[model samples]
Target: MGGAALAAGGLLLPGTAQAAPRLTTPSPVALDLPTVPAPRSERTAGSALRPFGRHLAFGADPSQQVVVSWQVPDAVTAPFVRIGVQPGDFGAPVAAEVRTLVSKLSWQKPVEDQPPVKPTTVTQYYLHAQLDQLIPDTTYYYVVGHQGYDPAGQHTRLGDVASFRTAPAPGRGAGFTFTAFGDQGIGYNAAATGHLIAGLDPAFHLHMGDLSYANAGGSGKTSDAYDARLWDSFFVQNDPVASRTPWMPAIGNHEMEPWYGSDGYGGMRARFTTPDNAWSQSTGIYSWRYQNVGLISLDGNDVCYNTPANLDYTKGKQKKWLESRLAALRADSGIDFIVVYLHQCTYSTCHDNGAELGAQQDWAPLFDKYQVDLVLSGHNHVYERTDPIRAGKATRKVASGDTVNPVKDGTTYVVAGGGGGGLYSFPVSDTYLGHETGNDKPVPMVVSERGGHEQTVKVTWSRVRYTGYCLVAVDVTPGAAGKPARMEVRSLTEDGTAVDRVTVQRG
Candidate 1:
């Protein structure tokens, strides 16, 4: 098989016989920024060059393509990936592309009251190998190596190799499970959650954004608190799970580093390559399909009224694209469920950051119109699930273990923000598995308004709220013709305790 290059229009072009594996060109934003060498202290000493932050992501079509990404501590002669159908038998090496990112020194403080910070310059090298034409429902083993090191050589170790299974073909009716969470930072809790998800053996994981929290301040403004080294810790912590699972991500406000680009997505684009099925070449907003399920990732910052720094950046283009994608998915005969995940919440009872009016006003209507099965978000650090909602009200109260039919009822919104971050409190009483405290009063929470303002509002749709570190796993059971498909959405704590569960069925 021959490798190909990704064209500017997101098409694959045949590579010449003599041409090495082609790489995607650097983004215009990255090309315009200046790059500098890392400080002596930050440079890799006399150690062998090794890869870290190894992770996988599905391409436009998960059934036939995947993108393997990793980072090197220092500049290497030639970095490549050796892949094969069997373990320890990687045939030929596929050349990898390097994306270099630079974070210059900053003396300004994120907050006026903070003390001046020391200056530091950091540079990172991210490598990616886009593997296409893979067999569906097959596992492929791979290892990363450079000129001085070879995994298949005599010095290979068991830990040097990793494998990933591609999604089944469309209409395959293959039952699969995937996990979702957000607001995961680098910490003990976060690491525990990663191990828990890996234990569940999910085919893929949806990171609802606020990934590394390198930028402690989520204001999306230029902050001196930003530390590029934090990303190193984050990837290392999650490498155990991310190396084998497709860790798909959504863009959150904390990901908005003003120093990166106009919309603050230059770093993200360089770090991870997502599906290119979005409008206007947006990296954060894209859609993909696996078996009988259709999944869409959105950039909530563009429509987040709470964080107005990048608000309306898309000029309503994202919403338009979303509607079209939803319509297409709803029209597809093979797609039994449509799930959307983003950073901010359309409805949440977290007092810190409740409902995002921007998203509710712009995208919720489309979810209702298309009858989306489930919506997931992670802005507030807690777990909350709403009743089947339509037109800003709960059509029916859906408790845990209850079944929901989006076609007849409405979409269900879930807030699984408790992904290892500090837990947040809700205006309503806590209610979940093993711990249930009923709340009869209307929960008074803050609603995001335009221009970075907040308004107090009382609502009764707040059903389940659990303040703890947790993640959500969704198991999809495909249905045959004339039968209804089922999806079991379960919320589990870092210790693997089920906090909440709900079944979604579609006819």
Candidate 2:
């Protein structure tokens, strides 16, 4: 909010890899960073067009842990990530799992064509192995490759070593830095946006949803491929931004599926893995603690597509989990504050689009009841914020000197759906209608093109028919002069400059 309007936090601190293209016994996959033309529509362009990479990202392991992953191309043979502290911090090296190339681009494959089937292009996924419990506020080094046993124990790794800093503990003088941007899937200025975002150089990044146009069709692999490739190649692949910074993502309608994949989210599941067993839950919805912040990531896919077999998700399970998670967090003495992220904004007219009424009805009460601080979401493919709403009433936005919001356990919601999927061209002309049922922001409802059964027919949870992608960044600092620093949320334009911003503080 400092740019548009912001409060302050404690202090600030800051912040890729590569692989092979082909496959052979000893590292055959060659990986190239695709500089896609427009709307980055393909994993590998047939022959002429440029292969694109867009959604580059990184995620944290609680506070000390930072993991990085990205896509590899078909030309490079064996691929892996390099590790170190800074540019030359390569004193000691750490490596993560070595990934093979993705043979079949499509999710539906004959049992006969598994693994390397339809090997037209190779999309390798790599991680920064074992970035385990690190010291808060410390930076690490890395490069792109692995000490693989390539052909008779030959080793291979393509990129150079890079550096990244861990999140600072709240008790550590100033703290950490994070940023959030939603609704960026247009592919229009995605590459530029990634570069723009990369310049800010925070500790970690957060995404709202709608990562790719392919996901709009709801193919599980398509969506995940977008995540891996875009993240590494365009967003983080050869880039150091994500190689060292952590990434936190919220489930979006595009990533949900009964529509494609062997089960659901085959791509998402394969592309990124979270600590599901930690809280005993599957899917993207889970929670982790970062410094003094308790962050919760939710599986909004279930919010739109509710079912029991999806029992892993659904209303009943989430409600129970929410209560239990909050209870534990509140009970703990170490936690300083709480924040939550998901694909749906609690206060929006599009609630009906994604059939989000169920989610809102179920979660809003819990947020209000628990005083969950802040909520981040994407769906409108635009950015909007509330001035601290409690039970549908406007409270004041938190500012300097304010100790806490007077409202009991109140929260502020932000809609940030823009991560290169697509861009929207709608204005908040009227109140949103359909399945959504919450109104907690200034008028001029932020909305997008109404996706329909066709959209849903192709993807899972068609309830909220729409398109676009998004990401978020957070900066955590100790309170200023005894007051908590403001929490800011913003939306970036295709060029990567802030379009709007809002600051959140205790009432």
RMSD of each: 7.4, 11.8
Q: Each candidate's lDDT (Cα)?
A: 0.82, 0.47
How far is 339's C-alpha from truth in model 2 (Å)?
Answer: 1.5
Per-residue alpha-carbon lDDT of model 2 for 399-459, expressed as tens digits? Answer: 2113335245267666666555454533232211132324223333322222322122111
The lowest-lDDT stretch of 10 consecutive residues in candidate 1 is: 10-19
Model 1 regions lying over 4 Å from their true place: 1-47, 107-120
* Model 2, C-alpha of 413: deviation from truth (Å): 0.9
TM-scores for all candidates: the values are 0.89, 0.67
Q: Among these predicted structures, which one has the highest TM-score?
A: 1
Residues 1-507, candidate 1, lDDT per residue (tens digit)?
012232322212222111222223343446545555344323433136678899899987998999999987766656789988999888788988766666665622322232233445466767788889999889999998876678877887568899999888887746989999999999899999999988999999999999998888879887437776778888889888999999999998889877776777667776888887775458689999988889999999988887888888988889989999999999998888999999999998898888899888999999999999999999999999988989988898888889999999899999999998788897656998667676557888688888777898888778788999999999999886677799999999999899899999975
Which 10-residue window of candidate 2 scores lowest in summed lDDT? 1-10
Total backbone clashes of candidate 1, pairs 3 or more residues apart or in separate chains: 0
Cα deviation of 281, candidate 2, in Å: 6.5
